[model samples]
Every structure is written in C-alpha cells, then in structure tokens.
Target chain A: MVMPMDGQLLVLAQAETGNALGETAPTIEVEEVGEPNPLTADEQELHATTEADGDAHHSDVFPPFDATTFGDQLLWLAICFAFLYVVMSRMALPRIGGILEQRKARIEGDLAAADYSRKKTDAAIAAYEAALAEARAKAQAMAEETRTSIKADIDGKRAQVEQDLARKLEDAEARIAATKAQALANVDEIAADTVQALVGQLTGEVSQAEAREAVSQVSKE
Target chain B: MADPNTVDPIHQFAIYDIFTLGDTGISFSNSSLFMVLTVGTIAAWLLLSTAGRKIIPNRAQAASEMLYEFVANMVRGAAGTEGMKFFPFVFSLFMFVLVANYFGMVPYFFTVTSHIIVTFALAMLVMVVVIGYGFARHGVKFLKLFVPAGVPGYVLPIVVPIEVISFLSRPVSLSVRLFGNMLAGHITLKVFAGFVVTLGSLGFLGVLGAVLPLIMAVALTALEFMVSTVQAYVFAVLASMYLNDAVHPSH
Candidate 1:
C-alpha cells in the first residue's frame, strides 16, 4: 500500500487483528511517516510544515504481510502437467535407453560366457577320457596280436622237429635189420668151418653138405 | 480519502468482470480474463509463427526463432551447457512473466505479479519441482547439498546447523524478494500519483509540484519495466543454480 498525501505514517489497517484500527485513521499520527522517510532529516524537513494543529499527520492502516496467503490456486491448476510428464518419460526416455540395455546385456553376456566355460570343460573332459580309453584298447589289442603270432611260430617249429625225428628213426630201424640178417648168415658158415676142423682131426677133409649135416646133428645132440 | 491506499493505481484498467456466479468465489475477473489472453497470445504466436518453418525462415518464423534463441542463449550463458536441459522450463517462465509484466504497464490491466499470491506461488512451485527432480535423479544424495566442503571438527556443531538453515530459507528469500520489489514499486507509483490530483489549486507551485510528480511517475514506470524483466531473469538463473546444486550437491 502507498503512503498518503498527509505527513503521517500508516498504522496498518487490518481486517481482524485487534492491534489494527479499522478504515479510519488512528487518533494521533503515531510515529507518523511521510516525505520524511522516518529514516532521514532531508525528507522530514520537506514536509515539516504540511500538516497543522494536533492532527500532526494523517495515517492509514497498513496491511500485514501475509506469507501464509500466497499464490492463486488457478495459476497452479497443473494444467497439461500429466501430458508433459508423459512426454518427458516416454519420448525423452527412449533416447537414453541404449546404454542401460547395453550394460545389462554386457553383464549377462559375461555370465553366459562363464556358464558356457563349464560346459566346454566338461565336453573336453569327456573327449579326453574317450581318447584315453581308445589308446588303452588299441594297446591291449596289439599285445593280444603279438601273443597269438608268437604262439603260432612256436607251434610251427615243434611240428617241423617232430617230422625230422620220425624220418631219422625209420632210417635207423632199416640199418639194424640189415646187420642182424648178415650175422645169421655168417653163423652157419662159421659152424660149418668148425665141424670141418674136427673131421680133419679124425680122418681127413669133408664135403660142404656133410659139414652142414654134422653141424645140424651136433646142434641136435 | 486520506488513506495511503485510497487510490488503486490499476483501477483505471478498462478490463472488467462481466459477471459473478452466485458468489461461488469462482468469478472470473478482468485479471483472470487477461491471464487467459496472455496464454492464448503465446500459443498463437508460437503456432502461427512457426507454421511454415524453413531452413531460412520468413519474418514470422524468424520472430519465433529469435525468441527461441534468446531463451536458449540465456540458459546457456547463465546455467552453462548443462543448463540446456532446463531450457523449456526457463523459456516458459520468461515468456509468461515477461508477458504479464509488460501487459501490467498497459494503463488498465492488473499486474498479477503485484500480488504475493502469484510470485510466491511461482517460487514455491519452482522449489518443489527442483527438489523433487533432484531426489528423483539422485535420491538421498540431494541431502548432501546442505553439507559444506570444509570447516573444522569443532565448528561442525555450529556450521552444520547454520548451513541447514540457509538451505531451508532459500524459497522464502526468493519469493519475498520478488514479491517485495513488485509490491513496493506499485505502492511508490500510486503514492506519487496521488500528489498530482491532491495538489490542486495551489497555483504555479501546485503546477510545479504536479509536473515533478509526473516526471517521476514516468521514470519510475520505466524503472519498474526494467525491474520486471530483471526479476524474471533472476528467478530463472536462480532456478538453474538450484539445479546445479542438485547435480553437484557436494559443491
């Protein structure tokens, strides 16, 4: 509120405060304010002679500063607010979303790699076991083959030796038979000679037939 | 008649209330009508001005471009590049407050800003939004705004509380400054004006006094205009500062 033409300070006109007077001015210019900005002498002398008598000054009731009663409700109707919020969240948000999704995917991809590593190791382990098993089976098969070949060689050598021994034995048997036959033939001749000798001692020489007969009679006696 | 507030400076404003709705207190006054007028004017200006935009825009489009650039440069300059994010908010604030203030000087329309209800409301709204935004973005980190950079171990008992008080008083001081400036300016304008009419019949001295008051009235009006724009800029800049504080609370 503005100051009055009179040289009095306003006593703050109020609607309901007890200390405040109504529309009417208070009795005496109480601490009156005017061109004399209660703070200065130059302003005071400027309006020193304006008001006369006991009136001293003319003052108006000043309004109190109502901090509580601030702002018009209409100004804050929040008109179009919902639409603005939606625009900001929807249209504006999508532009910056790539980073968030990328970060999530990167982390998830790392996790997937970690998980995949286990499976890979397990597969490699299985492959390694399979390779090891194959090697063992191959060695066993080789050893078995070596055993069977050695046994076959030994059996072939034994069969050859048996055939050679049989041949030798047969030859030996033929030789013995020849020798015995020769000996028997010689015995007869020898016995005939011995008988001839005995005859000579007694009476003189005998024929071969007579000798064989004498040998035979001597054999009988 | 002798009351300081006897003459309402804006009474002559030709805008008037056409009717009232059964005392529902929802009566649309001249001021309310003009507020709508301001909003519509801005909308039309934006739409029509930008209707046929081109790479090298025509006059209408250029006008829109200038306005946009003006707000952009201001935001960039005051709030830096980071402030660009709040361009829409600052731009809207400037347009609304600028229009209201310029229109208030139109010799008839009521200055909505002259009322504490308007200025304080805007201040509080900004505060709530800024605080809400910081919390939404950084959660509890916003509380660090009250924490100072350095002090002493012993001073914590005193410094922390004082800093907390200062932070809490932000909205109060902001609203009060704007409200007080507008209110005081209008009151001074009204007071000087009363002299012109009341100094009647004092002859050449009266004429001389009337002339001095007239000159002062014009000068003050020009000053008020400057003040209106300044206040809007200050309000916008402070809002940016608050945002910066939220972004870098430890600072």
Candidate 2:
C-alpha cells in the first residue's frame, strides 16, 4: 500500500511538472501535492523544496513586462528610431531616390537617343533606296537614248546604200538598151551587104542600091 | 523530467544594464545596444551601397534599391500617389522594424523589437502621424473616416461606434502584434532548443532520443526566421494602410 501511494505521488508530481514545462521526468518530487494534510513528512519536505524553487523562479518579473527596463527601452528606441528616421529621410532616402531617378532618366534618354538613331537610319536607308531607284531609272533612260541614237545611225547608213544601189541599177539598164539599138542598126547594114554579094556572084553585077532597096522591102514585109 | 535550472526559457529575455546614468533612471542596456546596431546597419547599407550611384547597380546596390522600391510600391499601392509625401516616414519605420527583427535572429543578440515598450512607441508614433496629418489636412472632415458613406441612417449609431472602437484599437493591435510575434517566436525557439539540451544529458540512449528535439529546434529556427520577415512586412503594410486614412479619410 505504501509503495502504491508513493507511485501515485510520483505520478502526480510528474504530471504537474510536465504541465509546467512540456517534458516528462521523475525527478521533480512532490511538485504540487494536492492533499497537503495526507502528505508524509518526506512528501512535505519535497513540497517545501518545490515551493522554494517556484519562489526563486518567480522572484524576478518576466523580463518583457519589467517596468524598470521600460525607461531605458523607450529612450533608446526614441534615439535610434529618430536618428534612423532623420538619416533616412534627410540623407539616405533622398540619395537612393536620386540614384533611382538618375537611372530612370538615363534609361529614358538612352531610349530616346536610340529611337532617334533608328529614325535617322530609316531615313538614310530610304534616301539610299530613293537614290538607287533614281539612278536605275536614269540608267534605263540613258540606255534607251543610246539604243535609239544607234538605231537611227544604222537606218541612215542603210538608206544611203539602198539609194546608191538603185541609181547604179538604172544606169546599167540604160546602157543595155543603147547597146541593143546599136546592134539592130548593125544587123540591117550587114544584111544589105550580104544580099549585094550574092547578086554580084549569081546574076551579073547588080546595083548595091537596088539590092539594099529589095532587102529593106523584105524587112518591112 | 527536465531540470528547471537548465531549461529556464525566460532567461533570454532579461535586460541587463551595460551602464547607467547616475540617478536619472536612464541607462544603456542590451536593448539599447541592439537598437544602435540596427540603426547603424540600416544607415550603412543604404548609404554605403549607393555611394557609387552607378547607372547599373552591383548586387548590394540592387538589394538596397529593391528594399526601397518594395516599400515605395507598398506605400503607393496602399495610399495612392498623393501619399508619396509620407514616403520617408514610412521607409524609416519599415527599415527600423525589419532590421531590428533580423538583428534579433542572430544568436545571443538582443532583439530590440521583442520589447512591448519599443513597439508600442512605434505604433503610437504612426497613430500620431495619422491623426495629425488627417486633422491638419482635412480639419473636422477627418472624422468622416468613422462614418461609412453607404450605411443606412438607422444603423449609423451601431456602426459608427464599432468603427471608432476599431480605429482606437489600431495602435494596441499594431504594437501587440509585432511584440507578441517576436516574444512568442523567440520563446518557442528557446523552449524547443531547451528540450534538446535537457534530453541530451541522459547518456547514450538520451543522446539518441535528443535527435528528435534537435530536428524540431532546427525547423523552429527556420520558422522563426520566416515569422520575423513576415511580421516586418505586415507591420509596414498595416502602417501604410493606416496612413492612407490620413490621406483619404472618407472611408
């Protein structure tokens, strides 16, 4: 029975200790003996020890709530925070803000410059293309002019050669006509001579005039 | 059972004086040291990083610029373009709280924002600015913030008081939110870390069992870091929203 009672006391003590500090142990003897009157002298002594420990622990106020530290904390907080506020507002913040502002301005300026450069480049390219197109058109016109002039020169030379050849052909036709008329006249004279020779050889000498007259009459018939 | 002496979680929050001014009750303490460090760090980071003022920023300059733009955009988004007048004030508050919270994350370093007085003062400062700016800018028209435009006339009484109450509780909530987060997060981390120490003392078996708590402590440390950053951002966002009321108090 005594052993069981001791076991119960140990269990109660352990339970209380565990509640105070979320860990279990058998070492905290009789932390809060619920029934003080039923306690043995040994249990009472253990309770006294536990009470002393609790007093020692609670003697100092919880540090967060300690009124004595309030003045110091408030003073330092004011000094540090005010100093920080002033430094930040007056010096540090403005500097950072300025840096950011400058960076933004620089970026914008660079972008604007880039945009201007791009526009200039576009204009230059457009100008170059325009000049190239104008040059191409000029070259086409010059080539057409050159070809027209060359064709006119060739046509003029061909017309002169054709006129010379036609004149030469007409002159040759006139000469052939003249030659034919001369040959016809010679043929009449030669016929008269042949008839006169035949008459002289066959029927006694006849008059040349009379043979010519007969031949002429035969040609007319 | 853990030894109470070895696992006293609240010991870390204690403030001890480094030097005290004679009889005036003003003393330099650990909290003061951290506050100074916080301000110094912010100043140096902002000032030194941007000293070059390069058109293209280096890594440090970019980081500083990002912090500036982040807070700037938040103020603008919450309050609008007219609220740019309060940019410096909002920036200061954001940096101080953010750097102080991060400073607290370093081991063995005091957390300036974990104290209720410090956060309360900051919240009050914000409220004062809001009220002062609202009244200065709009006169009695600032009271229009409490009166909703679309509310039916019969429900004005109930709705107005509720708005007034919520408006009055802003500083309390603001201060407590940051303080509580910092205090509770630090306490939780300390408690979990204490478990590892307490469990690791029992011998080879205890060492093996301690691994679980050790893992928990590491995870909690990561959670605490997130909590610190998030609390700082929340504080800044809320302050911006409140400042918006000063700029446009017509609900």
Candidate 3:
C-alpha cells in the first residue's frame, strides 16, 4: 500500500527544519524526524534498531493497496478542477475569443474599405480618360473648322484682288491706243510739209496733192 | 556532516496537513496549497495579460496569447472545429498541469501532479466528459465506437470486450502515465542530489566524485523540464483525442 506511512510522511514534513543545520545533520535528522511522530522515544529506539537491522522499509512509492488518502485527494482535486473550469470557460476563454473576433472583423473591414477605395480610383481614372478623349475630339473638330474658315477667307480675298488688277490693265491699254492715234495724225501733217520742201528742192514741180497722197498711202500701210 | 542514508528521496512527495477540520479528517494540506497556487497563478497571469485588450498585444499579452493559441490549435487539430466547443476545458487542463509540473521544479515546493490520486482525478474528469458527451451526442450509437467497422460478425464477441477494457483503461493509463513520469523524474533528481551531498562529505576524493553527479543532476534537471512540458502537452493532446472520439463515435 502506498500508504503515507507515519514514519515516511514525517520525514517529508520535517525536511524544511532539517535544512536549517549543516547538510550532514539534515540527512541524519530526516531519519530521526520520521520516527519521533508515531511513537514515544523508547518505541522509536526499538524501531530504529529494527530499521538498522537493514530490513528495507516498505518504501515503494506505488505500494500495493493503499486507500487512505484517496478520499481527501479526490475531493480537493474536484474542487480545484471545478473552480479552474468555471473561470476558464466562463471568463478567460470568452474574452480571448472576443478579442480575436474583433481583430478579424477589423481586418475584414479594412480590406473592404481598401477594395472600395480602389474601385473609386479606377472609376475616376476611367472618367478622366473619357474627358481627355472628348477634349481631344473637340479640339480636333475646332481645328478642322478653323482651317476651313481661314481657307475660305483667303480664297475670297485672292479673287477680289485678281478682278481689280484686270480692270486697271484694260484702262491703261485704252489710254495708250488713243495717244498713238493722235501722234500718228500729227506725224502725217509734218511729213506732208517736209515732203513738199524736199520735192521743191529736188525737182521744182512737186504738187501738194501728191505729198498728201504719199503720206496717206504710207499711213494706210 | 549528515549521513547520506538519512536523506529520503520520497520525502518531497509526502502530504502534510496545515489545518485540519474538526473531526472531519478533511484538512488543507501542502498538496492543496500548491494546487490553489497553480490555479491562482494561471488566473492572475491570463487576466492581467489581457486587461489592456489592445489590438496590438504587449509582451505579457503576447505570451498569454501564444499559450492560448497553442492550446487552441492543439484542440482544433485533434478534435477538429466541432471540438472547439470544449476549448475551455482542454485549455484549463493544459495550463493547470503545465503550471503544476513546472512549479514542482522549484526547490522545496510540492508537486501537485506527482500524486496518483490527483492525476487520477483529472483523468477521470476527462473520461467522464468524453463518455457523457459521446452518449449525449450520439445516444445508443455511441456503442458503435467499440465495434470496428467492416469486421466479421464472428469476431464481435472477442473484439467487443477487448475494446471495452481499453476504453475503460483510458483514465487509468492517462493518470498513471503523468503520475509515473513526474514521480520517477523527481525521485531520480532527488537521488542524484543525495549523491552530491554524500560524495562531497567523503573528503578530497569525495568532493571530486561529487562533480560528476552534480553535472548529471544539472543535465537531468534540464531533461526533467522538457519532460514536464511534454507530459502536459501529451495530456492535453490525449484528452483532445478522446474528445474527438466522443464527437465522432463512428470513427
């Protein structure tokens, strides 16, 4: 029986007191302490003498069939275990669980917010690209319209300038023609006078009609 | 110098009554004191660590959270998600056993787990929970746990009794494994320590001889610490396994 035999158990109880002295004394004191509790000094001596006879004490830790302390140990164990269980299940574990849940929820919420913000950024980029394309198209159309309008304005100005130049040329040509005809008439009169002088000098019988007819024929040619 | 033979290696495991109830035989003993201390320390450490409840945990909080997650993962792995319902029980058992085992390593302190009675009680609690939950959840079908699937019906008579005995022995095996490991380790440590004191007393050569045992004691102490932690982990893992069996009786 793994009985907490009085002798063995007393040795345990006196261990602290045994520590007070030198190491050697403590070891010897431990044996004496075990004997003193169960019997008077006289019986202890008898028992010590028996122990000294080298009969090994029934010191097997797991001695056969000892039921003495089982009741008290079981009772205490149940009490302690119950207390521990209640505290753990009711209070401690739930708190940790709640904290973990909170952390998980917080992480999920942050991820969701990140996802939402990312989507908003994508939408904004898309809108910006659309606006940029529309602005490019509008600028292109305005440039085409401006180029056509400017080309038309230049064409109209060129046409009007050409017409004005043609009119000026025609007027100048008519004036020049008139001047030539007047000069031709004067030349005929002078020629007639000159021819009559020359003829008188050369052959003193030239007629006025002959000079006029020569001048007229030359003018006609 | 004290005689070396006087040092009792088993002295540390003895229980002493600090205060006794009148005629009831029920008393507050050293074992009870350490048990209370173990629970109190666990409670205080966990509560204080989590008091701030910050999203970003502080050092103390981080340590506590690590332990929590470790045990949590252990349950989830062994028992699956459904087994998580019993997290509190498993966590409590793990922490209590772990704390008690480590606390035993402190010089002159009592080891609550070293006692067979205490370990047996804890084991019984696990067995009770497993059986109770199994029946509660599965009803008569829980008996199917003992009957292996795809077995010849002729083998039922032989296998059923063996399965029942194994099932019944779970608590015994569980309790004894922890108790035996702790008891043996502590005894071995005490015996080696006794060698240190005895050898040192034998004069010059004796002191030289003491060094070897001292070194071995140090090495064994390190081993014991590992054993303590591993045993606690094993206890929790086994409990979770049993709970898994309970939750899924068909397997």
- lDDT tens readout by residue for model 2, B1-251: 14633677676676777775664545678889899999999999999999999889999999989999999999999999999888888898888988899888888888988888789999999999999999999999999999999999999999999999999999999999999999999988888778788767777897899899889889988998899889999998999999999999997
Q: Which residue pairs in candidate 3 have backbone atoms (N, alpha carbon, C) closer than 3 angstroms, thus clashing? A: A1-A64, A24-B1, A24-B2, A25-B2
- The lDDT values for all models are 0.59, 0.81, 0.80
lDDT of 3 at A76: 76
Error in Å for residue A14 of model 1: 15
For B1-251, candidate 1 gives per-residue lDDT tens digits of 34433454433322223444453323344555556665556656665655554444678766666666677677777667866777666666666666777777776466656655466666776778678877987799887776677766887778778878886788887777776777677768766776766664467788777888888888999998998888877777776677666555677
lDDT of 3 by residue, A1-221 (tens): 34557755555445434433312233355456554433334333432222221223323333211233345566677788888889888888888877777888999999999999999999999999999999999999999999999999998888888888878877778778788878877788889878887887998978888998888988789
Ranking by TM-score: 2, 3, 1
Ranking by lDDT: 2, 3, 1
Winner by lDDT between candidate 3 and candidate 1: 3
TM-score of each: 0.52, 0.84, 0.81
Residues B11-74, candidate 3, lDDT per residue (tens digit)? 6776655665665546667778899999999888888888888788889988888888999999
> Which 10 consecutive positions of candidate 3 chain B have the poorest summed lDDT?
B16-25
What CAPRI-style quality would you assign to candidate 3? incorrect
* Candidate 1 positional error at B141, Å: 1.1
Best by lDDT: 2
Candidate 1 lDDT by residue in tens digits, A113-205: 999998999999999999999999999999999999998998888888888888888787777778777886577678888778778778798
Better of 2 and 3 by lDDT: 2
Supply candidate 2's per-residue lDDT for A108. 95
